[model samples]
Target: MTTLTPAFFAQFDQDRLTAADQAHYMHGYHVFDEHREQGALNIAAAEGAYIYDTAGNRYLDAVGGMWCTNIGLGREEMAQAIADQVRQLAYSNPFSDMANVTAIELCEKLASLAPGDLDHVFLTTGGSTAVDTAYRLIQFYQNSRGKPAKKHVIARHGAYHGSTYLTMSIGNKAADRAPEFDFLRDKIHHVSCPHPYRAPEGMSEADFLDFLVAEFEDKILSLGAERVAAFFAEPIMGSGGVIIPPRGYHKRMWEVCQLHDVLYVSDEVVTSFGRLGKFFASEELFGVQPDIITTAKGLTSGYLPLGACIFSERIWQVIGEPGKGRCFTHGFTYSGHPVSCASALKNIEIIERENLLAHVEDVGAYLEQRLQTLAGLPLVGDVRCQRLMACVEFVADKRSKALFPEALNIGEKIHRRAQAKGLLVRPIVHLNVMSPALTITHAQVDEIVETLRSCILETAAELQRSGQYAGH
Candidate 1:
């Protein structure tokens, strides 16, 4: 064991975090120690759609704090709600029929806001747990209905559910799961991704939609519908490059699920809570009533971690039946954490009181229109948007839509350029952006687009200088 001095512990403090200290103590997703040694931008404060680093540099948070922060940051109401809850009841055990008032209230509110018969809620700490819990519940439901062999899960390629073992197995992001996670459970199957931008060469949008639907049905048939437990999907794929499925794609998938008796699970972790101008995007935006909906991130607007798996009455009727002598046998210690629930309650109130959903709907259209302007850039292969969530795919050839060499790290280059220009956008492989906060205004949208344009131009120039840009 290494001996630690008081000074060494002090170095780990946020206020005293230095480049060396960060390299020693902190590591983030897909980041190496060398990158951390170069130093990280320490955010000291945030308000509305912007965040200020410790260096006093203000940045327009284009990704909305990992697509959470739906109502934006630095809300006094959210802070007060959390503080008040902490003082009154900071923790509670949600097991054994025990519950907290705030948790109950949040559940009730969520149930009322959810679509169709999805009125039952099981709270968790965040998106991953919500997804894990849903997967477990699906198994339990299957077993309860005398179908224990129905243990297989079907997910789409390029879908991002979460990070837990089960969720990661369900997700099809090859980069997210690699060398270390090579032994994932074999119960999950991945179908073709329904991305219009990368559709087959000669396939029309309608033909692509039909192809995707047929692929889903064929996968179900291959797995033997009775052996497949559920189909997991994100309303609009978040971390898997914000992939937006073609119109009516979700409805067709849901129909396949219904015909096969396989449960349809909507993983709306990023799209819920006004991100897509709706409480839940499954039924409202996609015209599909999922048997279960998993949500997090925006639930508390990143003020606190909270997630929920809402069950439809159709399934709840079987699983929640009285005297069944069945226990869920799964729950997180912080499943119904009081402070998180309180924060979520306040967050929901703010979204409703301010009519932020409508605001997102109006501004989202303008944002999409503004984003279309980026299509004029040579590097921009595709510009796709659904409400406030959008993505810009960069390619070496706009006509051929060929991706840049992976070694070039072109997406990271543009991300760094944008960050230096006081803007933050997510880099999903070959450049993809998601600005989900409802607080982003049309003016901010213009700023984001302009910053992206400059960053793309700078990246292209650098690529050209390096002889990496092949003229189409």
Candidate 2:
């Protein structure tokens, strides 16, 4: 393990951080005061696939900093690019036909790389804003066609779009919506998730795919096709446990969307920029061309905040019509901030110049194979992987596939164990997820597998000792 010297802490004034200050800081997605005594993991620095905390402890970031840091951490080239852009032009307004050179160039590059008539780009601050933009655009397009009733959206269970009100409404995680966000828009409806592991017993994969498609079509019909605005989906569900869909599922769902005149929106916030070894997973991996695609995270490798909603020519023609008297009237102050655009341009150049996509294709397969070997463990119920994204689900009985009681917090226990062993993985309920940097190597893969192996073994032993597990 690599440790930083005391001199490193001097540069950042680490002496100022106290337990009282930490207690006052409210962290997102975590229970307040849950770790008040221990304090949060104060990340000080990072390089490549490894991160160092304030105590100089090194850890392998298997979750890729919330599944965004694709190229890797601490790339000097990316930093220089951002600095150079800020020195030149720090910010610019994207509205009123005003444009910046960097943003213009980035849009052109993205359009050239995108598939099938997806040429128009609308920039935003992050994934949630991109999704919010897409939803509004879908409604605008329908209203432009004099079909104001087509405002309802169709989303699948276990799918995560974003955190904004509209995006959160489209998301299907029941826990995310309960008493707190119960006031989210009701126009969003959810269909079944095409999760192979959760499929009913005696059902073949082909049958399951058909059933999921039917469920989607039935929901549209039940809602009345004229009232449905769009269908939003992730190529692979991310925060909802990395659920990979059955084969040919997305294409069939696209066909249903076409039949019902519902726009298909692909949420590639976590899967784009080589996560699936492709610039965009919609056409390259899923074999479907969506009407709109919302992307963030990997666009700049999480070095800077940036998001974009790419539109198909078919939708653009209506919104871009010259006869329209009113403006779109929606934008963010940081919408095409030149610094973020510059960083994204440099990030893409590095990914292309390094041929990281090819690297991921080769290394990702090894990761999947190594993770699959854990299925022999008594607590490993299922291991699913596609490219660099993966999930390991824990259960009480492997044969019966019964999950441990929620109170056990099996995933969190495994996560803590792995972190102690110099590895970090995201715990989503009963699953441990991995979406490491695209630059991770075979040797690093070995470290991850070994650490995960030990963590699972320790967790199983703890459970058995506490009478929570009854396995050999």
Candidate 3:
């Protein structure tokens, strides 16, 4: 498919823009004016895996718009589907006894596509809400079964669930969560994540997995497993530095959850809908049949905000059973919004019809092979990938695997340099995570790798020149 081109370049000066933006806008994942003051590269438009800036600069979108837009941009079919739905029934509340046609149809489609007994869905506005809703569902399910003490949620360190109060507790990235308010006390517990690269020296993958599982078991026991509601995890940690767990990690965790009879909540928010070469990442990668699944991001491929907490029949029977004044006791005004549903229906169709999963497997393999070239670089410590998702961790000493000090901001500098060179990739703390559109071509991968190579080299040179590249 041919990518789109803008008619003309946008011309806007940043000095004048910062005053107003700083006064009004609150940016997420950014230091706001401190970063904006340096410059905000205004994106004029986007199509396929490329975005054009106000200055007419064209860049490869390596991160796929925060790792969401899986099908790429300029998808007329999805946009038109949304438009059609809006015209047909733009707004509707799925509260209590109400629902639109699109919502109903999308639910059926999702049920057919989801794995195992995950046939029922509770829709939400986006990923965070879906996560929040899952927590509520787990609690509600336990209550229905006459267990009121199962209110605590167990998550893992280095996991990024969401930013909502409940989800922030489940999320492990301390930086993502604000200082706890009085209301947030005693809400969540965390276990060590299984990242062999960050594991203790001489620890094998099996040892790491065993250690994490033991830690999880200890935490659950200490917290009183009867008081624990669910265990939340991403198939491969996304925003939390893209830390992929060792093999058999999830298998062991799933066994532990089963042993304790705790609900297993897999956060497929960043890995669902062909993003990981499957409809769901947990089943495809780890053989997990979660009691509930929290997902968003690729559901509508960024065309519209949509998320869902998919429950197994057992969970649905507990939550969705018909009774007077008895339901999940949760929903959003925009839950199962007609337009969003239509967009998702169309997006999923595109993914299947185009065989995007197979494409992801192919292009994803290409991406991994190309990325391995980066492993030997002076600043590279480890490279990770499981399909469309990939990341490179930077360290000051590869032999010792010692990270560059946070003060150096090596990752952010590399990100900025890549942006200057017309490449858009995300730097998560000390790693660069790339989640390009599943439809990206081989040429696009080459462009991304070449740009990244240049940026790393330049950043290394600058640091060395400044005496910051503390060597072996």
The C-alpha stretches of model 1 lying farther than 4 A from their native spots are: 1-16, 20-24, 33-37
In lDDT terms, how accurate is model 2?
Answer: 0.90
* Residue-level lDDT tens digits of model 2 in 1-472: 1336877755654445646447577776655555666667788889999998776788999999989999998887888899899999998888888999999999999999889999999999999999999999998899988899999998988888988767888898865765655546578888887889999998999999999999999999999999999999999999888899999999999999999999999999999999999999999898999999999999999999999999999998887788778578899999999999999999999999999999999999999999999989979999999989999999999878898887788998999999998999998779999999999999999999989999999989988999999994
CA lDDT of every candidate: 0.86, 0.90, 0.84
How much is 265 displaced in model 1, in angstroms? 0.3
Estimate, for each residue in 23-110, the C-alpha lDDT of model 1 and write its tens digit. Answer: 4655447466445546677676687888876555688998899889888888777778899999999998999879999999999999
**lDDT tens per residue, model 3, 366-402:** 9989999988877988998877889999999988888
RMSD of each: 4.6, 1.9, 2.1
Of the two candidates 2 and 3, the one with more favorable lDDT, higher being better, is 2
Q: Identify the superior model by lDDT, candidate 1 or candidate 2.
A: 2
lDDT of 2 at 182: 55
Instruction: List, in order, the clash count of every candidate structure.
Output: 0, 0, 0
Give the lowest summed-lDDT range of ten residues in model 3.
1-10
Where does the lowest 10-residue lDDT sum fall in candidate 2? 12-21
